[model samples]
Target: MTTQTQPIQAYSLPTPNGQKVHVMLEELGVPWVYHRIDIGKGEQFAPDFLAISPNNKIPAIVDPEGPGGEPISIFESGAILKYLGLKFGQLYPTDPRQQVKVDEWLFWQVGGFGPMLGQNNHFTLYAPEKIPYAIKRYGEETLRLFRVLNTQLEGRDYIAGDYSIADIASIGWAQSWERYGATRAEHPNVIAWIERLNARPAVARGLAFGKAS
Candidate 1:
């Protein structure tokens, strides 16, 4: 199967992780279809969705035109972003050094920023028993991570090089700054970067999708 024969299938919702892929696909201008996987409804654990996303997560994708012209399914939002970058030759650098720079921030988000912020969200908003220790721990960590990001963007327009996948990865996570007990006023550089990316038409369109429809 080739992309010409079938559209990319995206299983996701409006969450930050899901928004990452949605924003990427729209930015790449790829032909794709969106299938809302209502995680709140436990649809992520359904057998069919599980076959593609063993972790039972949203933001999985099925590409008809995979490497060697075969269909392939991918999970993990970061991997999906990299796959689309490699496939479309966009938003990622070809040079190994530049690619590494991009990967550094991308992985930073996947490994640190996203998880900590997610924990902060859980403790601050959804946790039935509001554990002050858990909330403070994750909240402080989220702020620390934001400071690191703000420092990284001190003079640059993006986290890594030239608005690549790294920016795409970080934006969704950073969007929850308030919920994570942080403020844009304290992170000027990050706020500037966020505004810059938010102004993009493609990004605006992607962020608008899968929203309570």
Candidate 2:
């Protein structure tokens, strides 16, 4: 570790899923060094990375300076965003009702968008061989999730009326879906939303941090 007087130690890749936390840290203006965990080569399944996250997923972190000097390690991308937002009380609303509104959308991405699009990526792109049933199944499911987001975003600049963790979780998957054959242009409002998100220099940097992006 190149010593820094910062609290966060992030293990991640450059993909949208991993970049979500990086974007959060940049948006929060917190100093942290990123230790890249390349899932492309199965580095996430290694013993070292497995120690922190048994599930072998990207975008995990450990904060040595967590509350009361307790070292905190966390996994699951959405949970990480939720923890950071509410713990810092910055990206999430303080008002209870507004916060729940954000929570609902955030949870939607965790439960719906990520999984659906991930399956689409598998069936449409990564599967060893495409099975018609799997392709149709995931493709339809992915499109359905997109329409839900498009309708929800009908009049909103950001999810929950402001740029919150809900936006983080949703935008991460949105970018992935676009990469997996879903054109943003098909959903005008979603295209506008992506442009708005890309306009952020921090988001751009965090995204570009991964050489592949």
Q: In model 2, which runs have C-alpha deviations exceeding 4 angstroms?
A: 1-5, 176-186
Clashes of 2: 0
Candidates' C-alpha lDDT: 0.89, 0.80
Give candidate 2's TM-score: 0.90
**Per-residue CA lDDT of candidate 2, range 1-213, in tens?**
122255688899877688789888887777777998867788999997888898999889997766666778889888888877766677888899998999999888888888888888878878899799998888888887777777777899886788898887777677765655556666767778878988998777777776653
What candidate 1 gets wrong by more than 4 Å, as runs, is 1-5
Best-fitting candidate, scored by TM-score: 1
